[model samples]
Target: MLGRPVSLIEADDASNVDTAIKAATKLVKDDRVDFLMGTFNGDVAIAVSEFAKQENRLFMVTGAHIMDLTGSRCNSHTFVFMPNARMMAQAVVPHIVKAYGNKWFMITADTVDGKAALQAMTEALKAQGGDVVGSVTTAFGATDFTAPLMEAKNAKPGAVILNLYGWDLVHALKAYTKLELAKEKIGVGGMIGGEQIGRPLGYANNAGVWGLIWDPKINTEGSKRFIQGVIDKYNHTPTSRCYHGYAAMMQVLEAVRRAGTTDTAAVIKALEGHEFDGLKEGRSYFRAWDHQHVQDVLVGEAYGKELGLGHYKILATVPGDAVAGGVEQNQCRL
Candidate 1:
């Protein structure tokens, strides 16, 4: 992107805050990397973002969806490329509320990301004159969700909102299906859900309306190219996680190309308010104020079987502007 060969170095933080800081330190001090990117855990990402700020390096947060990463805890050195909890909630909550009704039961992973999801969903629900009737918090890596699922079922809310992700989400869905919550007219959905969560749970078990980052069914030219590249290189379909990594890295490189230097301040300037094709149907840009990547968010309904490249059927394509709240709503001063 800079018209020069660029070297890449990687480290795994194991989703732990301390481990992530250590790994980031090595990348900045030992490897002398010009940029830092990638994190999957909210707390870990926050810790590393502070570390990056201290070191005066730019960090592109790719996966973690905690709102504070771009909200109250936002810093000039860190830019979030993934949709945060508020963005997802704004896009999906209405569909879920309309499909299932006003009352909700929540099953949230007890962590920063999960908390953000819970809060965002709650706010969105209330905005629509709805409320959470009952909720439960689970450990980050809990494997069994029988108790919580039963509680949610017994609450008999119009829908159950899962403020969980990854395997926690998968396990919850397993129990949700095993207990036949849908059969009882209790719908289920969440702020974020996509092929990544659905594939492991299997098509038959993946049920819900969800906020999706991306899906292969997106008909944009950029989307097609991205999907083909992933299929060719990895021999598998790409998920939203893949989209986050690819798009974030691409934007970072593009910023360097635009700035004509890897200098931190210059690149940061290049990225601020910069617009680009996000491989989606709507506008994409890093908001100049908060550095949140504002882009399209999709609402999808999971099917009992695969629909070609995905297990979810696209229900609506919400433009980024409609969901990404205005400056007053974004609590970041940076």
Candidate 2:
């Protein structure tokens, strides 16, 4: 993680926890590597967190939205780069309730990611002036959602916030369409709409649906530059996930640079209450109580039709708040 460029290793499978454990064991024992990155999956992130603790190595988790990473299982060696379930919940729930209140159902993945997302969203809704009709959680890699779709159709939520990623979200939408759930419900929630769900599914489907996306189209000069860089490098604009990785990489590298050493202790010290400049949405910091980064969340409705680079039609910004809700924040002395 220091003195040289960070190296990445895949977790082997998105569905299998054992594969991630094996990879982690190898990385810590055989490869003799320092801090690890990449959250191929939420379960993988959890597995890798424990591995990092046992091996006494630093771990920077990417693409995981589970609250438990920093929650009950939080360890000093683990540094979460991706937004936690609570942060994501904080980001979307307020806006969703304000815009479309009283009816919400969770199309959750049976996996850790889906369950956690559903829990977070439910809590957020209750926190706001909203009610959760009910939610249905399905197992990971479920192909047929007919049963759940039937339940959803009966429940008839105003919004179905799908807490899934990768090909899973795509499949869920397809199932929703096949079952005509999209036709019945207002749209999905807790996700930034119109970016991914729009392209493969078509703009027509995304219409009226909203997702909790971080609008990269902000007026900030730095945001423009960051978006341009992604487009220039990848030939396609960045989405929320891309932005998360980019910002996290930059933040981690900066923390290491500021600490002037890869020593975990020093880096941790420098990172606590640290502010990041020259980045889009300027002047964000990592809280000392919880490691969540202080930044803004984007709220947008689907509209654009372009592939990869299309922008959200209308966007509202929500300022970042504390991500200290995980078990680490509880201070339980067991």
Candidate 3:
């Protein structure tokens, strides 16, 4: 392991993200935490990013998949470590397009995030020769799926792709099953539709769901050791959240060594053309033009009994550049 001094802290972003901002502001203003990391909710990440910019600390995000963290909201001091919304859509375009071309009805959450997920997926659908027949949007954690799933059931979509993630998606699955929205006639899939989201879906529900991931539970040369490091360090195997967070740290650490100073500008310059040493995608880097880090994507299906982990399934690597979210000038205003 490379010798470095890395201190870790968890901002109480989960309790109230505003509290995360106050904590981050204090670290940057008082303690001067060399680099600010985390508070993964995009809104929290954005707040901290602004603080980082004002204080000249580096705000490197681990896995707050919102597109704006890098898209419209990017700043000189704010950098994303993991893939974003556009990247997610890009990763799965080929599979969804090729496997189930045409007719999609999105059962998206009635929240900002759901809207973004729906947007990214719709863009992907259009790219692969499909049309959104209609969509049903519900609140972030709406308990009732009777209305939405029933609409989806009647729409008779060639596919019904959900945009929800984590626990919300789990309830949505239960509601879908309860509403008798589970359709064998129509192909169904969605982001976070695999092990993490699938585990609660159970064997019967997860059996047919598919998804895209950055890593899989398979034996590969570097992966074995890499995963072991995660397990040893965190007392558990790395979740996508954990792996991407580590990857982001690795990127910033590399930039620090290259720059020899945590001066925001210097590190920014160092990261511009740098190649990160990730375990799965051994050599990865961001394009200077858009700060889009190119890396591997995987296609997987839910299988066997889930160990109540973040995600569990056998995954196959897709072509690294499978989705192709355009990279040149970003939408970031600044």
Model 3 Cα shift for residue 201 (angstroms): 4.5
Encode model 1's per-residue lDDT on 65-144: one tens digit a residue.
88899889999999999988888998999999889998999999999899999999999999999989999999999999
Could you tell me the TM-score of candidate 2?
0.84
Q: How high a TM-score does candidate 1 get?
A: 0.98
Cα lDDT tens digits for candidate 2, 297-322: 55666653643346465545655554
Query: Which candidate ranks first by lDDT, i.e. highest?
Result: 1
Cα distance off (Å), candidate 1, residue 32:
0.6
Pull out the clashing pairs in model 1: none
Comparing 1 with 3 on lDDT, the higher-scoring candidate is 1
The CA lDDT at 281 in model 2 is: 58
- lDDT (Cα, 0-100) at 221 in candidate 3: 60
Q: What's the number of clashes in each of the models? A: 0, 9, 4
Question: Would you give me the overall lDDT of model 1?
Answer: 0.92
Model 3 agreement with the true structure over 14-97: per-residue lDDT tens digits: 724679878987777777678887765566777778878888887777756677877787877777666566667766655665
Per-prediction CA RMSD (Å): 1.1, 3.4, 3.3
